[model samples]
Target chain A: MNTSRHTRIRSIAVLIVAALILEVTTAVQYYSTRSSVASVIMEMAQRDVSTINRVAEVKKIAENALHHAVPEVERLFAQGDRDSLYRVLQQIVREHPELVGVDFACKVGDDGKRDGYFTFRNEETGGIQDTIIGFDYTERSWYREGLKHNGFWTEPYMSRYYVILMSTFAYPVRNDKGEVVAILGADVPMHELSAMTVQLYENMNHSLVPVIGLQLLGLLLLGFIMFRSIRSVRRLSEVSAEKDLINKELDIANDIQTAMLPDSSQIHEFAGEVSGTQNVKDCIDIAGSQVPAKQVGGDFYDFFVRDGKLFFNIGDVCGKGIPAALVMSMTQAVFRSVASKENSPARILQDMNVIASQGNSTGMFSTIFVGVLDLATGRLQYSSGGHDRPFVISGGALRQLEFKPGFPIGIMENATYWDFETEIAPGDMVMLYTDGLTEAMNGEKNLFGQQRIVDAINASGAFETPKQLLDTMSQAVAGFVCGAEQSDDLTMLAILYKGNSAADFPQK
Target chain B: MQITKTVENDNLTLSLEGRLDTLTAPQLEAEVNGKLDGVKTLIFDFQNLAYVSSAGLRILFMAQKIMNKQGKMIVRNANADIKDIFTVTGFSNILTLE
Candidate 1:
């Protein structure tokens, strides 16, 4: 009972812990997921806004530099000064570091063909370098498109002079005749903006790595708890199943133990209401009671009337449980077989001791009180083998019978028991019990001693029937124990002598 | 349960204190299990011993049986309560008490 309760408590605790862990893990996961998504979105938005602002700032700087150089180059071209135009282009490239190059394309001989001089910074030497746009310069899209559109930003292309990706801001130039003559342009490198965007995406990926790893760890922990809980539940069921099987076996054993004794139903009837009106001649009222602390116990009592004599015995093995129970049953069988042929309780005990003591390596022993009551004479012959001396109640007074002590059976091979005789009158009772009665303990650890036994018999009324007498003793012990757990098997046997006068019974 | 052992020559004395019920009988059993070789006398001193149950009696019986084969065993200083138990159980016949 206690073990199952403890298991229940432990199971509840485990479930609560599991539930708590699950709740914590789910809450952490939900909040982490939400916050991580929000962070990623916020990072992307910031990156987009910053990238646009950077590009716009660079565009404004390039536009300012280009507008500043357009007029100088146009004035130099109108003068037809090639050196001054070249110097002006080189100065534009040097003045604004964001501009990769500067160029001027002229339409010559009215054929709408174009040639231009491009000046660019040499990145490694930090020097200005010039290249002539002499080969099919009119076929270039920037040159053709620049002539048609003013202040146009051209598609990005590879700069042959600077060997880098570049985009041009083209401004058309005209002479004092207000006719288009040439196109002036400023070029900017495109790699800077693209590299910044790549860096932003790389940082976002780095930030998500820890979050993904933490989610995996949480999942592993949950799996481990699930496995442990499953295993414990399986083990708990197995234990309960095993307990049930043991209990079933004990029930069967208890049945066998009870069956081994004489049928108590007849004894109960003899000691029941019939005692007040039925025949009292040559008849004895006897009853036995046994209560084992466990499902099966080591205490026993038996009685059978044979050849006009009542042969009876009560015994308790040294220990409780199965080992003691095995000895108890064996002893009972020995008593029955020996008493069937012998009339002397001493000899029966002697033969039993001899048989029990042989090869008793485990040192197990039992205390027994054997008796023979002659129904005709009311003479009782009894023997004690390390057993408690019985109490005889006569004339409203209870007295303990005395006998010489002998070692408990199975302890010494040569131990001898002596017979003690006592005469019983009509309306007298004899009580026999094991030490489990006197040694029974209460919650305070105090024993229900021999004095209490006498008092209980007295208080129960000396002339009560054997069954009522045994019941009174049982109630007394139970009351004294006060619901404390029984520590040993308690047994009691009562035999009431009703006298043997033929005139008292009338043969009914 | 506490057991104090004193061995001098062939005489071995074990002083036991506290209760020797079912739970602590095995401790005394382990101490005397197979260590009695060459001993001519065994003495159990129970001056401080408090209580004993049937399980404890079984252990004492085992020790007495062993010593009976080779030597004599003596139990000494049992209190009134323990002596009553010994007398009632008839252990007084098999065991020599002082």
Candidate 2:
């Protein structure tokens, strides 16, 4: 009976050791598999974020193009300037590859005749085809719905011309009497976006197979160890939950970055209030836009009126995304705080450099252009921190505003900046932009270049307002890029000086 | 980006080919930050380099800061476009270009 008890005890010990070994091996496999799966998911998530950002960017560009073209289209059509309308339509489609076609469907006139045109990219021949509206476009949904709504995004439908799936952004053009005169439709192919979705699905499936196989094997090993398997599943859910939290935080950060910049409407309202109290009406017309390649970018612009001077600045940090965004925010804050007490742009830049250079161990730097415009005399005192020289448009001529390019901020503690003076007439405009404008790359890796910028500005004709000119320039760049992904933030600021005089200004 | 590193005595020469952009800047950053040890002189050959983005500039700036205490760094064979970028960013004043 003692020998029988000894054998039984040994058997129990052996079973315990085997169970321990199985548990340890299963735990190791689960840990490694979890990490690998996490990494795969992380990579896939990153790609999805980037692709979604690009898709959103393309949509925004298309919307802007439609919005900007409305006024021009209305004006041209009112004047019966079909030639200009044709040119505009061709330019829009030629520049933006995403725009498969554009049509200006006019409202049937009192004479039972419709004057409209359609310009489309012929996918088979790889050429743009322009023709007068042939069919009964009055029955088309784009025309009917566009006239009914302020702006509409049409459901995806197969394009009869290109024989591909296309969606359209339809906008109604109004006459001076507030009557809808025509419907403007911009078509975008759905194939590219659909292809991206398909690619993402394929990637998920490729990564999911191994993950599933590993999980199955783990479950088989842990079938006897119920508590541990449950714990592993719980940990995986926690990891995925953390990913969702991270995505939400990133979106919040993007929103905060956008909120930090001054809104154009706020600037205008502030101008109005100042003019109401101080007789500074028509002193300045300012507009600016910042489009980040990613959700958050390192480009910033700010303008505020204080003590009869318009303190405005635009800056670009020497990188992209989060790190650059941090520096951009700091630089903008420093500029705003310094400009509050400082009257000289050079001094503000100097103080900014000193502050930024301190504790800048990461070697991050920013190129900034600061301007303090005197509303009374139209005298502008500007300083540059290795930034692009702004352009002045006066008397229907374009010229670069000359300035000494100083070292970018945060490079050296002792870097000094100099203030240069320039005078803008009663009806002059100044344009400031970052390198993203000139260095925009197309699919062929060719830069949009400074020459293209000059050409676009020159071709944009005489500017009536800052917003119109800014829109024209933006459209030009968008067209030049042809829907390629931008690698940097595109920021632009335009200020039209109307002088302190309330007199009717000279036209450019 | 391809980084060909050659060390002779106390001097180090890294010849670069292709683009130094957002995607490739980290690779070069790792190479520079991880390997600079006991080197008195460092040289960057950019004969085959085609482009350099702001990220590339940041990496170069970091390297310059490190070499300021250890030794000197020189950039060689930069094309006109690269020179234009340096001139605009004021990096020409800070970096030794040849």
Candidate 3:
């Protein structure tokens, strides 16, 4: 059993161990991916710049040919020599299949009229293509764009004259004063541009192989680690489920044990019935409370008015938990049976001792205090069975009541007990409690002694009724043991007396 | 809580150490549940025992009650504080201590 427990612990801890290892490796993988991708992108970017510069140098030669010819063409046109200009245009358009055509338009008059020039190469006949009349060339996108910049690369567009998607490079020719006089450029078909883009992508793909490889490797590693983690997740869940089962059982046991105790509402009902009568309400008031250290404890208390007199008992069994709880229940029943038949506190205790010791097979015992109050005379008859001495508050004095102690019940057979009596004067309060009160401990393990209890009573001002005394004292004990586990069961009872009539507190 | 046992023929001695409260009481209970079936003398060593809540006392009671029928049970090496608890709760009357 112990080995399996250890194995379960190891299985649960394995998840943390594996996760920590994976975390470090994955962190390394993450940084490697970033640096590798960055370097690859840097290399590709440099290659693309080199490729563009080379293509621009080649294309510039052809545009430069048009530029060099511009001055000559201008001189010839001024001389009205259209033939030499045509020769220059024809030489430029001669052999390059991609260079569809070359054109040069110049305004000769202030009316902005342009002398349009030409070249001929049809698509069906695949040499340099033909160009038609330049109609208002200023309105042309290439002309307007080139006028702004010396070298302007036009976007691929369908030319009205060529009737095909084409790209253009237009270079402006400037006079001595730097004013644009003419535009000279060539047309390239879209298919060649598409081809260059495809080649660039192919080169990028080759350089990117390592980056993509690392990414895929990281993904596979993550998948494998995730699978292992998922398997360990079940082990952790199994451990949690076992813990949950234990916790649920504890809650259910606590609930069942609490249900076994009589609810205060039932006690309140009896207490209420006995009150409301002017004489009983004025002459007597009784309250009792109990709190177990565990889900179930061995402390118990009961109070009732019998034969025009009040009788009460509070006891603590030797130990705690289920066994002591069972004995506690038995003690209550035995005390109730014995108390009903007997009026004297000593006789009631003696009777309970005999009955409790009946099956004395289990060596269990309880310290108890029993009391009988004579309502007419305001006298309280009481007995202690190895319990803590009771306390009384009268004439503004708080002290433990003096009494002879006897052996606790269930310890020995035919044990004799003695009863003691004290007067419950008007405004006097009587308090009966178990040792769990005085023996309450704090986090430092220091006991809350009987002197503290006496001080608590004196600290709280006059008790108007028994319940007030009980509540204040309970609160004091609770405050004394704050944040400390209740090491024992605590039970307390208090009785505050008034004179035999409601006349004590005069009605207006 | 740690429980170490030494067995010799009809005698068995268990050395108990640490707190024997509600949480650890069941362990001692399990060790005593018929582990002494054929043993004539069962002994408890409490030299290192720090505390025993009432729940722990219940288990001890059960072990004593069981041994009452078939063998002898005794506890030894209890510190003064533990002895005081036993005396106050009446366990000293029934349990043999040394």
Candidate 4:
């Protein structure tokens, strides 16, 4: 897979695994918490059910006592004797420790005197006592409820008689005529509930806490690791993507910059079309080349004949790389525009300066040698814009044609430039170059200089075609600076003026 | 190229070292582009400058233009070889030098 797809899959895989792990943790926690809650609810409901069951148990014991000793209880109650009923309640409480108090409640006279006593487990005495004997228990909830139900169990509540969260299991004591005379009750408190659940929990859910706790710890550790890994993955991908975009843009810029230069085949085409006569391509043979140290360079050479004159310029824009490349194109366009209308080298340079300085915010300039060759006269007039001198080779001799020093274009608006002139005989050549050639550095930091350039031109047949001269010079410079990175944009333009003039070619 | 910058009052001083050619000219231009505001005087200390191309001169022209509208700009302490490039290019006309 490609890197982006691979990275997406990796990230998605990581997320899936983490999500699965998280899902396990969440499911474990959710189910465990749900089970715990269910257990709590069950425990609570079980307590309520057991509470009801215990009330029934107490009623059964009371019923059993009444069934066995009802005759004695009624007789004693009628005789105003309570020792037997007190012994029975004490026995029931001792057997069922959940019960804190038990009593026999009854009515005695026409005024309805509350007589039977409530027996409680006294803390100070550690014995049964009749603490509720004198209290009027008829108006209370337990007595009123006991009278109403007569024999059923009552809901658990705080019994004023027992002074605890208690319930009474009450049943009626009937005389021989089956007339209800008194009620028997047993009070049970819920203070022992906590002890009951502890036993119930050990029997039901023993290993749940530690297992769920360990899963929680694992979840946290895995979550942290996954989060960190994903963060780093995203950061790495972003950086690589940015780098790729920049490299891609540089490649495009390099292609565009290289395409912007003047091509040699164009000259042959221009020569044929402009002259409108056969075999006039020999009148002006021109060739040039540029190589940037970086992928994109600021060196450019442009030439287009206007009205039978070859107007050409070679330039090195300030700076390098993308910024320089942009400036280079702008300078090339400006030169073409100005030279089309104005053929004078000086006027073209001046007009270019005006255009270049208008919104020149980047503070870059082009050092240029703008030259125009008259195909009819074999005369060349050129202007300098802070550019180096060109060398002319004719009649087996070489000489540098120097021009007046001028400001490089884009430095100042309305800067004046002056044109210089020279004549090219048959077999004569002109070599124009940027500083990249002379200032080319070697491994030992020595410049190739003008001497090597002149020597290279002389070594090559100076009378050869323009392309030969350029190739020879470039090869010599590259040979001198072998294995050393070229540190600047190297540009050179070579031209061999030919075929004398229009008169020499005569009419076909 | 190495450039050291110092700002005193409204004057910004830039000290240039090594060759200010195609590769290093932007370094100088970017340094002073932001600091040109509210500065009445801009100074270029070329004491250690050995070589300058038209690229370097272009930066000088920009600074001079910006300073001309705000205050004044000048290049001083230029060595003989560095001065010769300025002299030959007639950069002296567009820029003020000492």
The predicted structure with the larger DockQ, 2 or 3, is 2
Top-scoring candidate (DockQ): 1
Model 2 chain B is weakest, by summed lDDT over 10 consecutive residues, at: B50-59
Ranked by DockQ, the better of candidates 2 and 4 is 4
* lDDT by residue (tens digit), candidate 3, A433-501: 876787788887677777898888889878887788888988998898897988788878787776566
Residue-level lDDT tens digits of model 1 in A17-56: 9778878877787788778778877887887788678767
In candidate 1 the C-alpha lDDT for residue A104 amounts to 75
Q: Which candidate should be chosen as best, given TM-score against the real structure?
A: 1
lDDT of 4 by residue, A228-251 (tens): 687958766796887789888899
Which of candidates 1 and 3 is the stronger one according to lDDT?
Answer: 1
The per-candidate TM-score of the B chain, in the order shown, comes to: 0.97, 0.97, 0.96, 0.93
lDDT of 3: 0.74
In the predicted model 4, the residue pairs found to clash are none
Full ranking by TM-score:
1, 2, 4, 3
lDDT of each: 0.82, 0.83, 0.74, 0.76
Show pairs that collide, candidate 1.
none
Candidate 3 chain A: minimum summed lDDT over ten consecutive residues — where? A499-508
List the pairs of residues colliding in candidate 3: A121-A128, A121-A129, A121-A130
